[model samples]
Target: MAKSERDHQKVEAAKAVVYIYINHLAYHISPETAVLYFYQLMWDRLTPECLPVRDALTVVIEDEQFKEEQGLQFINRSYYSICNPWHLDNKKRPYLKQIIDRLDREPETESINRTTQALREQWMNFSKGEYGDCLRRQMHLGGHEIFREEDREFRNVLADYLPDYFYLYRSVTRTPDIEQLEQEHSHPEYSGTATKQINRLRESYDAVYEYRNLRQQGVTGIDHPSRLELAEFEKGLDFYYPGRNDSFKSKARTICHKKRRYEKYASYRPQVKEYLMESVELFPARTKSKLTESIDRALVRFDDRTSMDPITSKSLFLGLLDSVLLPVPNTSNILRLERCVGDVGPMNFTGMLLSLVLACPMIRFRLEKKLGYLYRKFEGKSLEGIQWVVDLFEHINLALVMNARKIGYFSLTEPLPDAA
Candidate 1:
């Protein structure tokens, strides 16, 4: 064979190898994982000598055609699996830093030394960037700003309470005299003085009102505060009511309900509801009724008791719709309403509506009126064009896979072990 033909054959073989590897890895591992694995394999196996194959593989993977075909353009519903570990790791980092900073500030006593050593080991693990891949995955998923905001809040809270660790540690080791502290405030002679101080503090900070409410609702230091709650109370006392010793402040902090940490999850309902309403509005009244009927039918599959509540049914129906329309990574879309209406009983009409809006350009004009944000992100291009691009990539990827298999470059029957 001529050198040109041989080079072409080599490139074809490499493309096939990548196709087989990507599909196999995606099945056993995950799509994101598979992509990373493919990148690593190419870098490791292909040397500078095989520039043709290397360039071909890079072009095939990076090409817009390939990406759209693999559903890489829109966020994968399974992408949340990638984010969850990172979210957990991100949550732990602040606490670990707090511990490390606290230990560093303390005198090097035997107990402090032991704690410091243990914390250092934990800090090492945290520094390993275990969630680094998840952080990278978020670029494609959108809404990453929410996670970043929460992380910032976590760090800010830690920074604000750095000095209160001393009190926090004392609270854990030496239990506060809850009854004595309460009595001091309640005593007739000291009552006026304590009440004046409490009122001043309450007036100064809104958190005090929340604390007082919790106290009125029966929360007390004797009930044993969580570490976080105890920390907040100690910090408040140290900053706002310094006359009270660390122990007293610790007891005070336990007097309120713990504040929630993050509000992003809480906001999901309104956001999803807004999108569902917008999508529904694009349809006529008759179509809207059909959509509702489909949701009601799907609800029947769940427990009748739970499905009977209109609110629950509505939320579930919206959740199902959201799952189909804007499926988040790591969530279950068992209904698969996005695929075909015939598969899900009585859901055909709703399914057909979704399919038309998502796939048909003419109908998308109506959809764009409600879902302009989606279009804006894609630079006002029609979904049909995007689908076409994806289809083109799928064809190329499959052809490459077939050519590689025919050339006997890689075995589809036996996949390599997971790199992860």
Candidate 2:
């Protein structure tokens, strides 16, 4: 066969795979699970050879081809694509970013659009049958209901001990079996410490159950004593077990110290705002307005900075760059940074810094200056005392070093001008 024919055959096979996958997803799982899970399933199935096909499918799905043809809407489609777990691996970042960049550059010109449209139409027609109707009904009921029967049986077995079981399960220590606890507490060998611990657990369980019951009975404003009960139980543990409570006390002290530091730090936000305003001139003319606007917005949103922890505070600052500087052009690329940093918890500060450099190359020095000041204040502090600040310092240093290396490489490898 000719090379062109072979290539055509490959394309046709990919389309078949995509069409089968989409139909299976739309009919079986899409409505039952969250869109993120659907994306996860797709990512798991997409091998290197299938990546181009996946990209094509992304365009088709995001462009609302299925919705337009079948009147089926996909909620949070952009989030599912951008925050797809597959994108988290650094190795996959460049490939996914390239696809995203190309899509942004030419969204209207997907070569496979016609093929995708035909596949979608076929899916819609096939899904209009009785079998499809049954699948749709099941999807509408959702996965939760499917497992509810099993859950109910399990819950019934622990009806009286649900609160205790839940508290133990959520605790840092090993969870004791409810049945075993009943049996062991009755045993003659049960020690005083074990008895006390079990009693404390029961007290906590009662307090929580009572609180929840009152809430269910429309008793709002009733103070919940579960936390206080648990704290007392923890205190008992400290009293009974030497050195067992030291870690807890140290953690509590650190939290209290952090709270004090944050209160002091918050007082300097006005100064930080003024500093940022002055540094706006450091940004290019095109980005200066947006950068200033972003600063103002962040200040307004996080006026009560003391309410947030150090990690949260840093994330909010990075979120400003994510919103203002990153010209990701489309929802998909927007998700790239959001999934990386947004509400997902503490990201690698280095990655955050690199992304900022990529988005706003001119702001690197300004970021360095601001972050350096913050770092110096916490430099000699204990790891627990300044972990967030340390992360910020790493972000700045990595960004600067990476940017410098790039610049150095370009300067050394500058090509000679071609002879006219």
Candidate 3:
């Protein structure tokens, strides 16, 4: 008979795997390591009951006295770095009229960690099918040793998902990208204060998102970020995961040589921060998750919204012209087509509407702005050539309404009610 591995043995191995995996590949450090470092750094900074092992995930375990004694080693620089507008220096961020910029670039995915079985199980239970996960989601249950292996895997996978982790604290990464919310927030109780702080961070993270989207989408008629600013935003995303070495390549490099008139900023950035923040702010506060239970409830509401509405489910596909269809973006027509519809469609109507959409410069600009597409002056000739698609759509929908009326689409009465 085979002997059983003690639970402690499994945990130790899992811990070693997590540490080594992150060190060799994931870069920076794993959250498991973060937990340990936090314990040592904070030293008695947290009351025993307030420890994160329970439900409290984000209360900073800062040793105030140690911070004073050991100087900057104890500083929680990562927490503050969340606001890129602030200086990288540790101390205080100036409370001036800080401009919150929008980030649209996606993160470098090459070295990011993958989900482990343990984390998948915990997350599945924690999220309760609220926020759908792409990976590590399939393996949610297992035996003792298997559970340990899963935990180690979770450490690996979970580390890569830092942006989503930020959402747990901040209430931003609500699942089911729906037009309307149907549930509340579901912040994990890794720790109370830590969880609360995550919520706060989620708010700030989300606020920056709203500011950028509203500006780009022209939802509020605000000025969109300039091309140079877009380049800078791309550069600013590097800090999300520690020791990230990926690059978002610069158009700045090209422009600088061509004109030699622009100032070039350094480095590439992670784009997740900007995208989710914008999406999170669109919800009403009642539907939004800012507090504990409020957020938990908000997740339920959000899940419902993300659920595709059978009555009016938006088709997700891109259409090519019947005249000439090509996957590559080669012409102004092709670029405009991608810009106007992205990956949304039902095929038949997608091609029809996109051609018209690109026909209107206003709609084109709106789609570009909403998607937060960086507008390169060298690329976009002008927001001019296409500008009348809006009237056409209005005419189309209006005609549809008229036809519906003629066909008696409305049914207001089953029968006439008797009046006294």
Candidate 4:
């Protein structure tokens, strides 16, 4: 419960931060500069309460100012760290004295358009179910020749590797276990709305999946974008606040000031704005709060019959919306996470750094030693089997280090490169 409380607090803080970020841009920032303003959105979340986040944002913003003072501009779309426009020797150029502040400063190249483009690309890739194509090893063992009795043992693992994506989650299309679902949620009048929502979900799943299937099998789903795409994807968070490095930390309470504002990638497809609005909406935390006052009074008669407990029930009810309900499949998310992990050290490294910067409290930081520790903990499992899995994880870490270097998060001056 104690740990859960801490986690709850963290989630709340992070959510609040996200709300502020999105809302800010919705009000003041232009679509063109929205990407740059994303940094400021992150800063808004890093208040006195979130000191580490605050401090990190301050330093990062300062670095940006410092770099502009020099002659270096930040590169966009790179992960790990801010890459500068100036060369190492360019630091020696005395002529760039006026904007020397920009030298080695953090870059904000991940503009809004770039973000949408990358998201669209990822979604397309995900929709197409392109999981196995990028596997470190792509094996085809789907023949009776290789399906001997011994190979049957590997069937479960093979199935696990196979991606299972539904255009819609089982929530809408599949009938709910009425006994397990909320009473109001299962009401008759709302069934019409639920049916429509379910249809939408199903349509989304089939449209994306079938389209991708055709595309993969030599049918083009849609024409690909050009070099000058929208805002690029960025990751690796600052410690000062949970969202200091996040592009749109506070997206929930977005207030649109523009009369003709569009979705992230609307320019590419004119209909994209409608798709986004239909697809996305903030989860209902405020709705539940407002409904609470009289909802209990009205529902009391039903509750006695249903024997419902509000305290234990509300959180679970709200959790469905609160979760990161991705447009992509779990296979895609897992693959992305694997790819991301390949680029990032296990979260242990980030946690330690955040602690160093934030000075907030104690956290169990151990990425450096995580490899050995996790191995030992799971030792009783099959040695050969577990070792293989561990090896996969290690490979991912190595990849993460590589990504870090590419994005300029950490310098790979000595030990990493030329390593045998």
* TM of each candidate vs. truth: 0.18, 0.22, 0.17, 0.17
Using TM-score as the measure, which candidate wins? 2
Q: Local distance difference test, per candidate?
A: 0.32, 0.37, 0.26, 0.28
Instruction: Tell me the TM-score of model 1.
Output: 0.18
Please, what are the lDDT tens digits per residue for candidate 3 over residues 7-71?
43443343333224222321244433433443332222222333332112111111122223112
Positional deviation of 412 in candidate 3, in angstroms?
Answer: 28
* lDDT accuracy of residue 273 in candidate 3: 19
Candidate 2: residue 265 lDDT (0-100): 40
Error of 4 at 266 (Å): 58
lDDT (tens digit, per residue) of candidate 1 on 1-420: 998676656544656545444445434654445445533433233323445544555544443333332322111212222222222333333322332232223232232333233323332322233222222222212122333455433332222221111111111111123223435555422322222222222222334334545666888764322132455443433332312353222322331112122322233333433434444554556555656555445434444233223344334444454434433322232123223233332222232333222221233222222222222223224444344222222222222221222212232444522211
Residue-wise C-alpha lDDT for candidate 4, range 1-420, written one tens digit per residue: 598676555544543443444444434545335434443433232243445544433333333232231101111111001111111112312211212222224444343553333323332332232121211111111121232332333433322221111111112112222212324455422332222323333333344344334555886435321111112101221121232332121221121111122222222222312222222222144432332322333222222223223332232222221121111334454344334333433333233222221211111112212322332234335534543334333332322322232222222332333211
Considering summed lDDT, which 10 consecutive residues are worst modelled in model 1?
Answer: 166-175
- The lDDT-based order of candidates, best leading, equals 2, 1, 4, 3
Model 1 pairs whose backbones collide: 77-329, 78-330, 79-329, 80-329
Off by over 4 Å in 4: 1-18, 26-28, 40-420
lDDT of model number 3: 0.26
